[model samples]
Target: MRLKKRISPHSLRHSYATHCIEAGVNLADLQHFLGHQSILTTTRYTHLTQSNTDSAIVRINALMDSIHVDWGNVK
Candidate 1:
């Protein structure tokens, strides 16, 4: 798996963080996952796109629905 293109550790870390954000992972959890003392640092690593944001919102809504809690009303 050798190629002319070289990938840096920062690139991998940034990609992982971005994917996690796209997967609807909580930012605070991501911060801890990345071992960043400051959440701002974690934010620096993650790049958010509109599509990823929409998907994350959908996933979060689905999760909330699954928990039977919507606006403090239990279903």
Candidate 2:
């Protein structure tokens, strides 16, 4: 049997980590699941969390609102 695409064990591990982070799994629990000696290793998935993206969007919108720029006035 042959495969068209190459898939590595690490790819599955990475996917698990990403999904767990996005699903709001506890950091400590994730750390245990991944068998990492340090929590820092699991922290890499923090950037993939939906909450982080949502919070960033909220902050950007708030900043834009605070600026109150008038696009119509610009020539």
Candidate 3:
């Protein structure tokens, strides 16, 4: 019998989230998958690349444009 222990639980969590993000899953979705109570809490658990943020912003802007809505006038 042999036992191996190189990675810890926290490391596994990080690897899981990183892999998921790299696979194109959204952060909000990941937060739910990880059972996080708040998006803020999940934000701390993962790192973001500039490309990811830029792409998200682009998609959000596109969506907003499609809706023909102006957030500035929401109030």
Index of the highest-lDDT prediction? 1
Q: What is the lDDT of residue 61 in candidate 1?
A: 95
Residue lDDT tens for model 1, 1-75: 678877899889998998898787999999999999999999998776898878789989999778876699888
Q: Rank candidates by TM-score, best first.
A: 1, 2, 3
Candidate 2 accuracy as lDDT: 0.79
Report the error of model 1 at residue 64, Å. 19
On residues 26-72, what C-alpha lDDT tens digit does candidate 3 reach at each position? 99999999999898887777787776789899999998777644676
Least accurate 10 contiguous residues by lDDT in model 2: 66-75
Ordered from best to worst lDDT, the candidate numbers read 1, 3, 2
Q: Ten residues in a row with the worst lDDT in model 3?
A: 66-75
lDDT of 2 by residue, 1-75 (tens): 998877899767887887787677899999999899999998874554567689679989997777654775622
Off by over 4 Å in 1: 1-5, 53-75
Please say which candidate is ahead in lDDT: 1 or 3.
1
lDDT of 2 at 3: 89
In model 1, residue pairs whose N, Cα or C atoms come closer than 3 Å (at least 3 residues apart or on different chains), thus clashing, are: none
- lDDT at position 73, candidate 3: 62
